[model samples]
Target: MKRRAFFLKAGLAGLVVGNQGLTSCAPGPKLYGDKNFYINKGYQAIPKLKLSKDRIIKETVGLRPFRESGPRVEKEMLNNKTIVHNYGHGGSGWSLSWGTGNQARNLVKTTDAKKVALLGCGTVGIATATLLQESGYDVTIYAKDVPPNVTSNLATGTWSPSSRVCAEEKATPEIKANWEDACRFSFRRMQMSLGLNDIIDWGDEYTVRKQKPSGSNISGGHEMFHIDGLNPEWKTLAQKDHPFKADYVRRRSNMIFNIPSYLNFHLNNFLIRGGKLVIKDIKSLEDIDALSEKVVVNCMGLGAKAIFNDEELYPISGQLSCLVPQTEINYKLATDGAYFITRKDGIYLGGSGIERSWDTTPNRQLTEKWVDVLSDLMKDMKG
Candidate 1:
């Protein structure tokens, strides 16, 4: 089948596409008590996102490993081998990789083994292995798949530490405290990696709303465990200060990752540091026992649901429709249940969280919905 026909048949024809310029909408008349009056200083015009089916490069699906009680960072003994559990970060796997890696490293410190085997090569596994290597442990990563194929590659690549990390009722005081530590540590680590081959950097994100926000907008039970400073505060923009057509526009600076570059950099770094990567499928505990290393850190993400029999672990499926990279559209935008983030590889449009879903198949209807939402917003912007 032809690429264009395939996309059109998959419902890409619903997308509104054109050269829509992002001129600012006219501001309301100034009033003495009005705080939303147009301001010129610090105002920057946003460029229109040229969203089209023709620009779409690919669509991907990822199953986020969600556990009701939050991530498992504890340790246990399996077949006399030290097994440190470090999986289940839900949608925040990439965002909280380093912090969880630190927790896993601490667990390994209790063991006498200098060589460690890491299961899975996703964000968590790679991050944990890299930390272990830096801490003087010879590490070998065993995984069924690597980057560009792993679940982490399908991530939106935004820094959202608490998104679907745990259920609100399960977020006990102890969990909140531990999560705060992880979030803070991870945020610092992400900031430290800025400007290194453009793997990570800060980008402005705008959240447009048709009505004024009356309460917290944080979703996926994140508001209960919101970490101050680590979670950047959103500043509500005045009508004339932004280009969005919505009544309420809020902006915040957040860390964004170029997944391909970021993963490649870490993977290459691990290889250079004498880290071994074995392509192996671990089906059961006995498979891990067959390894030479006595200490194993399980960073299998959703795979832990079967291997470790974690009843609380399940999948929260998400999908991303990637378009050709737009150099002018550097900033991210979120509105009407859809978001757009421009990375070096592509401009990713995504926003779907279906809990308890193990299906990794990309939904054409959902893809069309996202494109419709984003293209509608773009078309409303003045030319």
Candidate 2:
């Protein structure tokens, strides 16, 4: 009895010692060559990457700077070094990174500038900047706001971009071919990681379908649904197991992302590899043309309307109500013009499409409405 008691006491002492040193010894040296490596053996994902990786994804919010016409990714009105315009990605910036970034990157291969200047620091700008930096050019991001500060982070990103690309008239087959390349490329890039890149994820996408919804026919730059078609560029929703939102609720091959994870990973990657950022509200071309003499990557997003004077640019605002997270609600839904997504600590509930709702302010009325509607849906789920 005494021997067992002594051994138990010794084991308890060892466990206490191990735990006691955790705080002081945590965040230890690099392991197995991965810079942010650690030996956390049985560590479960506590809550969400948003809180755990706070240093990487500094902030969260949303904005709108899309173009009425498809993404303007070709050389625009410019001078000096070769400028590959890569902005106005609408809602699919992360979803179209490699695909679109490659298009812009292709325009500059023949004329490799010593340095590159990317205008915005949102997803579109960051992806463009990162690709350029990776290709051995000194890259600088000039923007009024940076990651966690920009609108890209504000969105509850899904893998669907309805009118993100403009109509057939605006985005010619040639430009669309470039756009397709951007899509496939971005998808491929996501394939490279082991799931730590939170800004993007591979999961089932469920948009509650009612009827074959028509996309925005008029070009006021507003879009609501991208939830049909077989073999969609990303993936299509499943029509087999339909939901009440429509006659069919299709399960598609798609993404459910935590934007914070995406921002922090790339932001850290950029900083680690020696990239520069300047926070400047560029009022004119003269300001940028005067600041850095590098070949500029015009990833201005919606800023091009004034700075680049492209009237095709417009706004499409999206709003979501955040509820406490429930893992059971792992899937996402789009029913009766509303969307419900289960992200980290919150279940994003929303669906508001006021044509001229350019305001980014949260709508309390809309929030209340969605909450009531969602509560009814929850009951329906039970019924």
lDDT winner among the candidates?
1
- 1-383: candidate 1 lDDT, tens digit per residue: 69978888666434432212222343644444322322223446466787777787899888999889999999998877999999899888888899999989998999899999999999888989999999999999999999888989989898888888889789899988888888888888888788899999788988887777565643322434676565678888887777667888888988889999999999999999899999998999889999999999999988888888899898988889998887867788888678888888999988888888878888878878888898888777643
10 residues in a row with least lDDT, candidate 2: 44-53
TM-score top scorer = 1
The lDDT per prediction is: 0.84, 0.62
lDDT of 2 at 372: 62
TM-score of 2: 0.73
Question: Counting only residues 3 or more apart in sequence or on different chains, how many pairs clash (N, Cα, C under 3 Å) in candidate 2?
Answer: 14
Per-prediction TM-score? 0.87, 0.73
In each prediction, how many residue pairs overlap at the backbone (N, C-alpha, C within less than 3 A)? 0, 14
With candidate 1 superimposed using the best TM-score fit, by how many Å does residue 104's alpha carbon deviate from the native? 0.8
